[model samples]
Target chain A: MSTLLECKGLFKSYSGRPALKNVNLAIESGHIVGLLGPNGSGKTTLIKLINGLLTPTQGELYINQNPVGVESKKIVSYLPDHTYLDMNLKVRDIISYFMDFYEDFDEKKAYDMLSKLRINPGDKLNTMSKGTKEKVQLILVMSRRAKLYVLDEPIAGVDPAARDYILDIILSNYEEDATILISTHLIADIENILDQVIFLKHGEISLISSVDDIRSGQGKSVDALFREVFRC
Target chain B: MLGKYMKHEFKETGKLMIPLNLVILVFTLLGMVMLGSRLLSTPAMALIGIASLTLYILTLFAIFIVVYVYFTVRFYKTMYQSQGYLTHTLPLSTGSIVNTKVFVSLFWVTVTVVFTTLSIIALVYTAMGQEWGKMAVDSDISFLKELLFSFLLPCFSLTILGCLEQLLMIYASLAIGQLFRQYRVLASIGTFFVFYIALQILGTLTMFFTQFFSMDRLFHISENISGDSFIPFYRQLFSVSTIEVIVFCIVFYILCYWLTDKKLNLE
Candidate 1:
């Protein structure tokens, strides 16, 4: 499969302090890549750059060999760490909103998933718990048939059951040929499902390897390696 | 897309305005009742004073609504804050998002203006014991035109200003907010303070320029003009220059679009 996203020597800084420094990475289709990083390690910033939310201070970011812009947005589905749906909006309203804007949004698939999850179409978002809201957001993101799915901390701040459900929903809904780049600090829960792992430290890629390679060659799980590498 | 934006805008604005509208209605009703009881008073000035006071109160309410509309327009920018990540990540261009807000803000302000005008007219009729329609007919043609123009022009100008100012604020807020990742509230507050200070400085400079231009001989039309005459100055201030106002409004809208489309930072 072709590379869906390519970042070369990417650099981003906020208020003259570096958030990301010369980060290099490439993502291909048909793989779930884990973007592992601690807090303030520039995982969100890198995701924002890839999704065209933030312009890079320097270096290049490309989706399908083209620079990030409106075209990139069309192919990228982003799930932010925070809730992005208005509290006043119902589940159906948000679905319709996505449908109106995104040509590739699968309304039927979203509805099916929502119904299976017991999320009512008429339920107001404000009335739902944070975990439910996160589920609804995940449903919206997973419903898209974009080439790249950038999920930033999709399972953060949720109960164990909800986290499992979120992971299951993502696994079930992702298109087979598309790329899912999930950024999270919860290494162990997701380490099993991730096909490839990219460990980010101090705003740079410290390691990138396939899960199988890490397991067979190193004789250790990605989580254990992560703890060893990132140990204080 | 436009319809959906407007529907949400109306719903959001309704949350804040429903109570304010109720208050305005209550005060208007009270004014009518008080005016009706005092109709037989010996002093005519008392009745006129009461009528004028009622109208002034209604005007004040209208101003509040206009101001409310301004903030409502601003709220649309942040309305998606809890969800801005989703909104900015949508396939739609940023231009559409801002346009949706402008249309809805204009719609609500227009609605409020119409209601305020109707309530003020009702208060006038109730307080004066005169048929508003008949009095409107008897009122001088120029006076009526001036009145209509004054009310309508300001409402239109305010709507345009609401659109432009809020768009600028949204862009500025988004750009500045991205500087602080987790603590976005601090960034917003810091940006607001910066914007406020800049606005004050700009206002002062504009006032200075206005004063400078007024002193220029070419700027004054009447060479022998009497500064003592308040009527002519008042008439000029409320002049019904529809064409000029429309052009200015178009310019303001273009500026809003330019700022939002080119300068917005969703990060």
Candidate 2:
């Protein structure tokens, strides 16, 4: 498999404090990789760097061997942890906005997902419940035919059922050749869907291995290993 | 992509601006009717007329506030707030984004100015009637033309340039403020005051330099000129101010674009 993302000595700092220290990583295509870390472990910072939202203080990152720019943005569908959408816009309006900007955006797929959730396209975003808003955001992100989908805490604020639904949507969406990098602290919820997991601790990658490898070698699930490794 | 960005911006801002313009139009028309009609001349109707006049004034004030606040808030919220997540991720350069906003802001500012000017003209015409026409014709045609070319045209252009400068200044301040790890809004406000003071100092220096270097020459030329040649004098004054405004605008635009492009911290 070809590498979809590569980070070379990536480091990010804010206000004289390091958010991400020197970290090198390579993610290949066709696998779901869990970026598991506790709060402020630099998971979101890494995702933000990948999406070109935040600039790195040192080193470089690349998607498809290209630095983050318009070309890389074209292929990366990002769902931020917060609601980045305008609340005044209707669901259809937001979808059309995505369609206008992203050539890879699949409008029919987005609408179909919305319909499956019984969400009216005419409904304004501010009127929707928090879970519904998150679903809409996820639907929009998933509806893109992007090469990499960076989801930052996708199931953080939702209930267990909604989490499953979101994960299911994520699982069903995207091409098999594409990669999904899910950043979350809810390891147990997403552990089953991940093929490989990268444990990030205090701005560095603590471990990166396949779930089967961890299962056979460590005689435990990925979540159990994460708990042991990140025990407070 | 810039076109797409502009289209989205227009769609979002138009929802508020179009209705505000309509309200201004409605109030203008109502005020015209109240002032022109003879039915409101009675003592009892005087109270109604006063209320109408007050409401009209309030509406006009509201238009100014709305236009100014809308552009400021939109720039801050869309590019720096949570919405920045969506904005910065788009496959477009920071220049394109800022350009779209500046263009949209110019459009709304022009609309507001035009609306206000037309409303004032309508109100004057409604009150003064044929006297306004007489005053227009009684004025020297050549002198009026020169006044328009020198004074009014430059003033209009200066106003437009000033609007662009203000928007860019706000954008630059917001960009600078984003560097702060906390209290970004406070930082933005503080930056604005700093920029304001810098602008004032620049203004004072420009005035001092212009007067020190050219005031004597300008006065000598004015003394040699014939009847009512103040148009050239005003034009020269406005030209210098216009250049100053344009320079400030370019500097602010560069500051805003550079910071937004490189030092973006959308935390």
Candidate 3:
């Protein structure tokens, strides 16, 4: 596997306050990596840096060996932790928007996912429930034939059933050559799916290890390790 | 991609803008019929006619205010608010996005200005019944043509430029406000006020500079001997104002583009 994402001394600060310290990371293609961290651990900042939403204060980041830019954004699909979709647009209009903007977007797959969830294509986003909105966002992200998917807190606000369905969709939709980087605190629900996990604490990387090594060598699940490592 | 961005922008903003403009035209038509047709000749109906006229004026103001505010708010929300997530992540350059928003808004503003001018002309022509021309130009077609070319057309262009300048000022202010970690909206408002004050200073300085250069010639126009005097002073004034506004527009646009392209911090 080749390195699809690499960060060298990546750092970000807000208003002179550091949110991410100098850090280094590299992830291979085709792996579902869990960015495990508690609140204020800079997971979102790192994700933002990768997505080019926030400029790094100090270091370098590259995706597919390209710097973060329009070229990088073209191959990276992102789902933010908020209601970031245009609330004024209907689902079909948003689908059209995505199809117009992203070359890798699959209109048929988007519609299929919408139908599976029983969501009307004509429904406005502002009229949808929060859980339904989250599901719609996930569908939009997963429908793209992107090289990398950065999802921030994808299942944090959804119900258990919707979370499971979301995980299923993520697993079923991703291609073998693509990578998924999911940032969340609900480690147990997603532990079984992650090939690797990077634990962040207080704006710094505390640990980065494969799930198999943690399970087979330490004989403890990632969730149990997380509980023990992050116990206050 | 720029074409696509502009097409999407027009579709999104046109739905409401088209109806509002049509309503203004409809009200103008109704006003012309009421005032010019003598439809409200009765005593009580005359009072209703006055109220109708008042309503038409209010409607005009409302449309203008709504257009400017909607454009400003749309820019802020789409570029800085939560929806910015999708906007900033697009595979298009930041310059294209800025261009799409500015040019589309300028197009709509120009349309509104044209419609407003037409409505005013229609209402005045119907109400005054050839008297406006008699009073303003004494039925001299050449003078009227001169007014159109020299004054009215230049005035319209200046009006459009003024709108663009104000819009860019707001954009720059909002861009600068992104530096604040909290209360960004309030910071935007405060920055706008500061920009307004700075503009007033620029205006005052221009006035003083012109006065200082002209001495008493700024107000006193005594020389009536020459056929050619620097293409008329009014034309010169218009040219200066146009250049000033264009400069401000460029500065603000660059500030907005630089801040958005290099220093974007959508949290």
TM-score of each: 0.77, 0.95, 0.95
Candidate 2, residues B88-204: lDDT per residue as tens digits?
999998889989988898898888878877887898789788898898899889888877877777888888888888888988898899889999989998999999999999999
Residue-level lDDT of model 2, residues A1-232, one tens digit each, is 8899999999999988999998899999999999999999999999989988789999999999999888899999999998999998899988989999999999899999999999999999999999899999999999999999999999997888888899899999886799999999999989999999999999999999999999999999998999999999
lDDT of 2 at A161: 88
The Cα error of candidate 3 at residue B223, in Å, is: 6.8
Candidate 2 error regions (>4 Å): B38-55, B217-228
**Residue-level lDDT for B190 in candidate 1:** 75
Docking class of 3: high
The lDDT for every candidate, in the order shown, is 0.73, 0.89, 0.89
Candidates sorted by DockQ, descending order? 3, 2, 1
TM-score of chain B of each: 0.58, 0.90, 0.91
* Number of the top-ranking candidate, with DockQ as the measure: 3
* Candidate 2, lDDT over the whole model: 0.89
> What TM-score would candidate 3 get against the native?
0.95
Candidate 3 on A1-232: residue-level lDDT in tens? 8899999998899988899998899999989999999989999999999987889999999999999998899999999998898888899999999999999999899999899989999999999998888888889999999999999998897788888899999998976689999999999999999999999998999999999999999999999999999999
lDDT comparing candidate 3 with the true structure: 0.89
